[model samples]
Target chain A: MKYLFSVLVENHAGVLARVSQLFSARGFNITSLTVGETEDSTISRMTIAVDGDERVMDQVKKQLNKLIDVIKVVDLTNVPQVERELVLLKVNATRQTRSEIIEIVDVFRSKIVHVASNELIIEAVGHMIKIDALIKMLKPYGIKELARTGQVCMARTE
Target chain B: MKKTGSEIIIDTLLDEGVDTIFGYPGGSVISLFDTLYNFSDKINFYLVRHEQAAAHAADGYARSSGKTGVCIATSGPGATNLVTGLATAYMDSVPMVAITGQVASKMIGNDAFQEVNITGITYPITKHNYLVKDVKDLHRVIKEAFFIARTGRPGPVLIDVPSDVQKASCEFKKITNVEMRSYNPTIKGNIKQIQKAVQMILHAKKPIIYAGNGVIISGSQNELKEFVEKSGIPVTMTLLGLGGIPTDHPLSLSMLGMHGTAYANRAIQESDLIISVGARFDDRVTGKLDEFAPHAKIIHIDIDPTSISKSVNVDLPIVGDAKGVLKELNKIIKKCDIKNWVDYVSDLKKKYPLSYTKSDKVIKPQFVIETLYDLTKGDAIIVTEVGQHQMWTAQFYKFQKARSLLSSGGLGTMGYGFPAAMGAQVCNPDKLVVDIAGDGSTQMNIQELATVANYQIPVKVLILNNGYLGMVRQWQDLFFDKRYAGTCLGRQKNCKPVCAGPDKKCPDMIPDFKKVAEAYSVKGYRVDDPKDVKSVLKEVISIKEPVVVDFRIEQEENVLPMVPAGAPLDKMLEHGLS
Candidate 1:
């Protein structure tokens, strides 16, 4: 099963390495991870997606909590969440293919961030499914380059 | 008064009630050493020859004294040298704080000479670590290091302070308490789980207690004994868990694991309920996980939540300190009717006693261990390096109290005993401290003899001089068709044209250990006959200065009652000859 955890850690050097090292060293599979500063400057918030069985995920949660730099770990998978991921892709878009690519981007509520004579750099933001849908729609145009930020999330109700 | 970072370190240490420090000076830590020199009267700092010994010594001190041990080292190589010791302490959950000097702040990432990111390197091994770039954070970092090391599931913590921080000046402020919001350990076990354990233990026809280091760490020996007596349940200890209960106690199964006693394994296999306290169900103790305690429902009580349900699933897990949970269980529990179970385990114990194949000519390592135990009346603090002799000491020496037997059980580090004994003796001047060493391991840190002699630490290094790394050889002999590779300590390296083949003419022994001891100004003795083992140990134990006794034991002797790795408990080789 997949589990998403929102971890609050000490905002200092090497905190990221410590969290990632725990996953790698303990053999926990990290599906995706993103970190950024929280409201408090001294604390950093990390959104981590882990893939493992119930037992493995339980252990991973306990082990993450064991790290001193890790302040708190909240299982956001079951909680009502507004998870978002951002992806940027440079697709081959000749003058003939440009109008069609812009139409597809518009349908997905995405934007063409950059445009050259032969390519269009499309920017995407939404649930992971929407991002995957956008990439699938643009696959025919030949994706010359692609970059993604691991999902970041917050509780939906709050 | 304003003080340099070095002075602040000394002040904080004094505030923490640290009496001794095991450290070696280097260029990066020159300022800290100078400050320590001026404060020598206030704190005792032993100048170790190697940074590794400093860390091991501190670990030994921590394990035996039940206090958080401290060691200091300089940057780069010196800091790296402490890695093995830190890992050893970490694996065994020994409370320790290691302070290492780093390159100056500005030169940290520039790859300056002797500058390494020690905190980054030791991330996996240490429970917590800090790199103090700011001078004012010195007190806070050191204070946090000690607190993190000694609290909850205790383990080693490292603090890497840059060279400039030690020189930078700041006002000394004492941090009495470190409150880490994310770092609170569960101390009290849940009433529901305790009740479940109590009912299971009371109702089970054949219940056994499997305990380990947590019992000793919690100082729960008396509580364990009381519970054992009240429940009429037999107890088995892990290697590191020795001395948690006296071996002579009728209910005490000396140790259980790969090289554990035959009866202990039998009891664990047959038991209907296994109450695991403080033990993490290490692979060594569990044998083949699939077949481990097949008939038993496990109740695991450990302070560390991560330890519960790690290797073996627990029917009930009580996440609390051993002492506290045992205390609570004792309050509401009535005596259990386990007479039949107790008698059954007792019968097994007598049926398969720990008996060695005796060699009457040259000394047997078991004889030396038995004689040493008899001579010391089992009162000595016995430390051992890793190998067959270590297993022998664990088998033969009946430890009667907590912290009586100290060895690198988890990491299995060789050369741990000699310096560890020194650290134990430094803290306990009146107690008899002995390091039962293998010839291969003794040579690893023989340079520490100078430090031992200079201070006259009265530590005895009893080398079971077998001319081979006996443990690995035993494995090869049993499982690998006796193809001895580099296990022989005296194997001639890269044979000359005129040299003989590997098997026939290798020198039996390398350096004469007695001469090595003498060269270091420490007294030395060598005994080749089994008959003289007792007298030699007796004589050495009475010596006021550090001494090394080399007992040239039968080289082929192997630790017995071996459970082949990944084999079931029932598959132990009760007697190799049989």
Candidate 2:
């Protein structure tokens, strides 16, 4: 099973190391993690995706909460939530393939952020599945480079 | 008044009501020591021989006095030296504050002399840590460090001050309180959960109370006693939980785990309900996890919620301080008689008592411990180093009060006892403090003898000289076909790898302990005759100064009722002894 957790921790040096250390030390499998500053400058929020059974995930959550820098932890897996991820893909394009790439991007509601003589940088923002789908469509044109900002999530307003 | 960071630290420690500190100084902390000299009248600082011993000493003081133990060290090596001691304290939940000096702020990451990222290194082990780059933050950091170290599930906290910061000047403001919004620990167990736990207790048939160090940490000995007595539930303890209940009490099962009494292990295996108070189900206590207490419904009460259900599944978990939960349980607990179960447990106790063979020639370590217990009337604080000697002491020494027995339970740290005894003696100068040690472990931090002699602390070091690492030797003897590989301490260069058992021809024990003690200017004694054990112990106990008595006991004695690693508790090897 996959579990998503929202952890708020003190914005201090070595806190991220502490959290990651906990996972490595306890042998918890982390699927994806994204950390950034929260609304408050003094705190940082981490959206972590982990794959484990209920008992293992329960321990992961509790151990995260045990770190002194960690303030709060919420398991958002079952909650109604919105998740988003951003990906950038640089694809090799010829004049003949440029039109096809633009057409595919238009169909997916993504945009070409940069263009060079032989390359097109496409930016896509959506749920993880949509971005992955966008990358699949661009794979035909020969992807030169690809990068992703791992999933960031929030509880949806009812 | 304008003051240096060193002065701020001294003032803050005074405000924290600290009367003693254990520390070793170096170049990075020279400024702090210079300031300490001026405040010598207000505080007492014991200069330990090693930084690690200083940390353990502080740990011992904290456990014995219920006050946060404080230790200081210099940069790099000094700070690293405290790692083992801090981990020991962290594992056992002892309250300790370790202050380490760092290199100048500018030289921190440049690989300068005596520079280390101590706060970063100790982050996982410490409850919290601070690196005060600004002089103005010194007082607040110290205040917060103390609060964090002594509160909730108490553990070691570190404050790393750079050398330049110590020399920097600022206006020292005395802060009387620390407010940490994110650091509050759960104190009161939920009322509904408490009610549910009480209901479960009421219906339990074969109930057993499993206690741990938390009972002592939370100062809930009385509450635990009341709850156990009122409910008539038998109690088993972890190593750190030994003194939580009177060892001699009829319902008391001294300890339960790999080396626990056979009856206690049987009761745990057979019980229908287990009420765990402050004890995490550590692997040592659980043996083979899948088969441990398979039929029992566990009710775990702990201040640290992570400790619950982390190792063992719990049916009912009440996350709160032990004293608070025990008080609530005592209020609502009803008197229920499980006469049959009690009788069964009593029979098990009688059938397999903790006993050993009596000897006439060589002294058995257990006999030495038992005699010490008899002479002290079970009133002395018994600290022990790790190994067979430690297990024997735990089994034979009857602890009647909280904090009566101090050993490195969680980390099983060797060389913890001698220095810890010094710290305990400093805290309770009127009481007799003894370190029950093994020959292999006593030498780990034997340099501490200089500290004892210099400070005039009357701590007795009783070394059970077995010449081999007894625990490992026993394991090899049982499982490895008696192939004593690397377990021998005094093996000569020409000695065979599979040498026969200890005999007159074996090389002499290296670096004779009596001479080592004499080199440090402390009184030393050696006793080999079993009949002279009591008289030697009496003579050493009467000494007004620190002394080390090396008792050369039987070489082949192994701790009995042994449960092999990963074996279920009930499948104990009685070693064919009657």
Error of 2 at B457 (Å): 0.8
What's model 1's overall lDDT?
A: 0.90
Q: What C-alpha lDDT do the candidate models reach, one value each?
A: 0.90, 0.91
The superposed Cα distance between candidate 1 and the true structure at residue A91, in angstroms, equals 1.9
Top candidate (DockQ): 1
In candidate 2, stretches whose alpha carbon ends up further than 4 angstroms from where it belongs are: B576-578
lDDT of 2 at B514: 89
lDDT of 1 at A83: 92
The docking category that best describes candidate 2 is medium
Docking class of 1: high
The best candidate by TM-score is 2
How much of the true A–B contact set does each candidate keep? 0.95, 0.57
Worst 10 residues of 1 chain A by lDDT: A51-60
DockQ, every prediction: 0.88, 0.68
Q: Per-residue alpha-carbon lDDT of model 2 for B1-578, expressed as tens digits?
A: 99999989988999999989999999899999999999889889999999999999999999887899999999999999999999999999999999999999888899999888888788778888888899999999899889888988999999999999999998776887798766888899998999999889889999999999999999999999999899999999999998999999999988999899999999999999999999999998999999998899999999998899988889999999999999999989988678889899999989999999999888999999999988987888889999999999989998899998999998989999999999999999998999999999998999999999998999999999999999999988888877888888888888876775788888888868888899999999999999999999988888889999989999989998787889888888886333
lDDT of 1 by residue, B1-578 (tens): 78899999988888888999999888899999999999888888998899999999999899888899999999999999999999999999999999999999999899899988899899999999999999999999888888899989999999998999999998776777798877888999999999988989889999999989999999999999998888878999999889988999989888999999999999999999999989999988999999998999999999999998878888999999899999999898888898888898999999999998777797988888888888877798999999999999999999999999999988999989988888899989999999999999998888899999888889999999888888888887888777776687777666443421234455657788899899999999989988888788878888888999988888788798999999998899876734
